[model samples]
Target: MSNTEIEDRQFITIAIKNGLVSKEKVDRAYILQRRIYTQAKVHKPICDILIQMGIITEAQKAQLNAARNVLMGKREEPADEVADDALPDINTARELELTISKDGLQAFIHPEHHQVQDVRIEDLRLFLNRRRIKFGVVDDGQIKSYLSQSPLPEKSFLIAVGQEPESPTPPELKFYFDTNPLRIGRVNEDGSIDWKDRGKLPQVNAGDLIAEIIPGNPGKPGKNVTGKTIVPPKLPKIRLKRGKGVDRSEDGHRFVARTGGMPQLIRKNRVQILSTLNIDGDIGLETGHVEFDGHIEVNGIVQAGYRVKGASIRAKELYNAEFEISGDIISLGGIYRAKIQSNGNLRASHIHTSDLTIFGDVVVEKEIFESTIETNGQLVIDNGTIISSKISAKKGIYANDIGTEASKKCDLDVGIDHRLEREVNLLKADIEKNGKLVQLRKADIEKARQRSDYLNTQLGEIAQEQDGYMVKQRDMDAKLSEAEADKDELQIAFYQKTIRELGEKRNEIDAIVEKYLEEDEGILANIPVYERDVAETEGHIEAAEQKIKALEIESEADPGHPEIKISGTIFNGTCVTSPKATLTTREDYTHTSMRETDVEDGVTTKKFRIKTTSL
Candidate 1:
């Protein structure tokens, strides 16, 4: 029987046997009896005595312990509600938007929406760039919007925010992680599929047994570090036991304390709370998650589970704390005690302050701690020293000076410091020392503008003085125009006269030749030989004409349609063609650039070309 059932049966039997308790009272007294029954130190005889004494009931203790067990973190909790899915399930995958801003990147994290999370400032919140987003830090808020509001710290520790969105999938749903069979052999234990070993296909026992992870928990081995809690009331000694008489007697000194008394008496430094906070988990004294908005500056050590997001954050101390961040971060300290992380610019002075893992660009005025920095822009250092901070930038990193190890992609850059120095100088020269320069510039601009009016007056005086010259220039231009027109007319007329003269000369020569032919003398005798040659050419032409006629008759003709003319031509080791349809033949034509192809494996090179043809 269940513990409750056994306790219930015991309570009923005791009441009935005693013959003093009424049935209604026995029912009500079940809970008090159960507590006495379960108290290991107390005897079963004592429990029966308690039931006989009408002190407690079985059901009430069961209910009480059940609540205590849950509070103690000993019981498995019912399913917790996962965060709500916030990403819209819009049908269209791609969308675009545009807006204008006077403030460029300072006020805006990204120029375009997609590029926001990809954007990062140098050296402040280090780990907030394109590569390697701060893990365990994704939330429902739009990542792009976060960076626009602030710039990362120049040399600061990094922090990340946690607030994972709700699960979109329903209960009983399955998910898969690795599908690479070569690297990690596939296992089909998801909810949709049956549990099957590699290359084997039958189902396993029940769905619950099909989980892929091996069965083991730190319940007995590794420190849970979860269930322990500091007393909820900061000074529980003063608060919880105040009215309940003097709580403790530590040698005439009464102090409010737990049921077991103060930890000081036990000599345990870490104050432990017997009570539970949300299932009685461990109080987060050394290492745990941190979430904040405005600004976080830590003077003490941060051990681990270090996630911080805010408009700005400054950590004086860090030791082995993982960080995810959305905004700016700065740290005066080092990370030898912990690993520092940031989404935005991360700048820290010494190794102890910022041994960093940066997602954004790193701009360290001083030495970079032994850490990995990945950024989208430039890795900059104001000082020429880096103690093994591995850096990578998507766009090439520009360091003012290249260190010996700069060739190794992961090594830090010495050149980054020079650029940083120039930046500092520029800032100083551009603002602090530019007052006199600004006044000078304004005076120069005014003088130049006044010179324009002065030049206009001088131009008028010069124009009057050069009036005669201007008249001469106008006459010369007119003469030049007239001469050009006359030359064109004369050239046309000369061409016509030449043609007429040549015609007359040809007629006179023909007449003389005819006279010579009639006299049967000299050149006229050779003319008959030329006539014979022409007759032979005519005979060849007649033969070609007959062959062409026969071919034309054999060829299929389409009427009232575009004509296809065949002419044989070779160009660039291949055939030349005008625009022609399939099966149409083509030949000799002046090969224009468009008509010629460099014939590669008999494939036609296709390209569009523009050419001007005269009408």
Candidate 2:
């Protein structure tokens, strides 16, 4: 073969190896060229044939030709020179068009054709001058560059832009305390809901700065492209008015609390502070829902379906009501079917069918029946009996009697902080969920592997079929060439038809092979992704387990040695659990005390055990 023929073959080889074109498409183009030559007695180049078939673009052909020339020790022409030679002659008759936005904020310049002559920087400047664009004009250097470009940009060029006027700042009132009251329960960090944690009221001390007036300024005006001044909107005026329990500073710009109480906004411009809220009668429809930032005192019972919140509370009785107090609570009468949460100590007469979460100590004068109480401090019931109650206390329990013979079982858990125990339970649940997610990810990976294997088998079968078709097509091509040389028209037609049929069959096999290969690749790719997800989920589970272990260690280090002490008869079915041990009474014990003690079971190791003794 000649050097030119070798170069052409090298170009085709390079294009195929670089993934610029497929080998199958190149082969088809060659067949088309051969057919044309056989019928018209005219030969066409492979590159030209490929381009005519829309398989390769002109730029792609140029790139391949350049590479082939470099490899064959021929000098390659510059890319810009080649591009210039390929471009058509410039259109000198077309004029430049200018467009401005109706708002006079933007201006753009357009050319009639891609290759236009006589486009100057002065022409663009004149267009802007005619449009009276006076502000935010684009740099002149950019306009010159746009005019010098070989092929003008298809989109319009931004020549000028205008500035917009700024809006004025309105006067605002800034309060030091919380203005929006929290009326609902709060959700804890561990996704647990605390129904009694209604938002705290805004409180202030005597002489504390409560509010201030912030003055606003008038914004500056702006000039547009047409030299028109744009004025800003007017600022609203605000005045501060002092109400009861509020004092103004000497400058009259700051407001301070005169007394220690809750600061409240009385109308839109008034500030008032309430020191205490007093209810002379029952808190029902007459009092509505009572919420205050200061102390609250109720003379009668809090009726059902009502909620009360205060920093500290004192009530005569609570009946099916809810109370959220940040400080201490004192109830003189019995609490029935009520829910109370207090951050400080609680002293009540009797608690029945109630749910209480107290952060401080609890003292009851009467009996506590069918109740759930969780306290971080000690529970004292010197003269009361606790019946069928579930109590969890971090400190200890001191009661007269627990669990009557006819009453339901009473469960008591002490020593460990209830908050830590709750967190551990939540972590355990998270670990379980993460474990299930890991299993699901593993299952998905297994399914993907199975699919990949099936697709591989299918692709292998398609490869064999494609090979068979190629062999038959080659044989038919040889027969067709022989008949053409012998001038046998009938034999030529038959062999040509046979070759085309074989080529069509090969194409069908190739399509099937491609589809199978794509499916196999997709499955293989996702297997690693699923594996990564499983690994991440497993990591999360491990972290949660480690956290639980740390929390357990902390819980086990209780220094209080909390226990249940009963001074009167303790009947059967009364169970008490400490951090280290648990004790359940099987028979009645009179005047007994229960505590945790370390005991040895015939070995060197010692474990905690609950011991009972008669008082």
Candidate 3:
């Protein structure tokens, strides 16, 4: 038999033998209790079952308890009483000898002075204070655990540790560079400073973030053994100092260049931006290599084997100097045996360079011989000879004569429309790419929004279902309370079963509500990310569209026209080029004009003839 069944049988036999209760009443109560336990898994005591079923009374249970106590030979518990006149005191149960290190960074104690049980936490604190070792504190539990170890402090054990003060961080300067400084001079492979460009000029653009003054960090205060605060020495002040052509930030943290110029750190303190570095004489050992931020003016020739860079240059003469220029160049004398690159227009009396690349228009006054020239704008040569040179221009090429009488070949390429065309095509391609991306981003945002709406609907439905379950549970509780107050056994049992069923329904609703809320939170979080993606994609699409429109306008404005007018005689063996065709001179002609014209065959043809009127 089960333990519960044996206990029930023993209790029934005892009650029947003592004549305290009848077998029929006990059996009825036991059957009811078993049915309740089997249905709901609620195990009620036998006395409570009997009382609920009106088969036993409280007075009878009390008499039975007295009899049971006598049979078991047990005594009852006694009542309590109060005491007066209690005194409070600190713990002084044990003695400990504490010692601090010379630097006040460490504190140790000897645990052999007392037994582990006799050690007191308050007495240890008092001893530490009296010895003026007040920086670090060891807890009571840690001390007790340490003392419990078999190894006593024959070697003193470290308990408390003090903190050290942090040193000050000095201020420094940070540079914002646009060009690689290492490329200016000879650079080493290993990661060490190259002093070749130590005094080299540093360049900056207008409104450029030149340098930032990193503020110094103050020292942190520390505590000594006696809890005395140790203050650190003050650090030197560093400022964001500026000179002419330089500006400082409002917060005094950054130094910015107000004008486009070369930066110079003078007197180890202030920064100044020199807009133009003037060289009165030739660019040689006297002027060093030029690397200025703004315009450069060389009154004399730039010698061979040197590099000169500037925003714009007005050199009287240039010879074999490597030049990287950003603005227009005006060379009054000539250029010979040099390599030059100009970001803006170029004007030179004569160019005999091996390589010349100009982004803007090119104007050569005299002869351009044995050179390769590439220009994005118009190529104009005034009464000059282009001998044995390759010249290409985006707009048109104009020269008085192309080749010499010695049959020196000169290649000329004009009517070049690819510059603006390429830009327009690239912009169109970017627009299409960004458009597709925007569509994809829009779709993603819509999908997320739809999912969010669905989740919100589910959340609302769950909330409604939960509200109904709550109402039913509350009603069941009220009915159970009413039944218990009336002392009606049948009503109480019926209401208890109803309440249990309502509780199970409420639990199901709670699980559903929790699931809906969690899914809703995830959807809400993803909504912002999708929204941001959509916005960024749209912005890219708009920017690409604007660029395409601007390039289209520029391409429309580019008209390819080639024109060459000679004031003097054009010799034989000279080659001339037009937008449509090339003409080779067979004989000398005076006041010659070379141009393109539409022929009757509907193809544009080149015409070279002696001019009667001014073009």
lDDT of all predictions, in order shown? 0.35, 0.76, 0.66
Worst 10 residues of 1 by lDDT: 86-95
lDDT of 2: 0.76
Q: What's the ranking of the predictions by TM-score, best on top?
A: 2, 3, 1
Residue lDDT tens for model 1, 534-592: 45545554554555553343222211111111111111112112223111113212211
On lDDT, the candidate that comes out on top is 2
TM-score, per-candidate, Cα-based:
0.20, 0.47, 0.41
Error (Å) of candidate 3 at residue 94 is 99
**Decoy 2 TM-score against native:** 0.47
Candidate 3 lDDT tens digits, 1-615: 776666556545545544456978887887888899999998776767766877656544443443344444554321122111010011221234556778677788775353433444444554565456667666777877766665444567676777766778877777675222212123347523233332233577899888887888888987766676766667756644687799898888888888887665532345767677678989998877889876686778899888988776777788887989865566766889889887667767788855887767777777899998877777767457787887877666656766676846666665555556566778778778878877887787688778878878887887888788788878878888988999889999998888888788878878877887788788778878877876887787788778777566554545665545555555665555554567666776656555555543555446533222244
Candidate 2's C-alpha runs over 4 A off are 1-283, 286-301, 307-316, 322-333, 340-347, 357-360, 403-413, 416-423, 453-468, 471-475, 521-532, 557-562, 567-591, 600-609
Candidate 3 segments exceeding 4 Å error: 1-276, 281-293, 300-309, 316-326, 332-343, 349-360, 365-372, 382-390, 400-411, 417-419, 422-426, 471-560, 563-615
Stretches off by above 4 angstroms in model 1 are 1-288, 304-311, 337-341, 351-360, 395-615
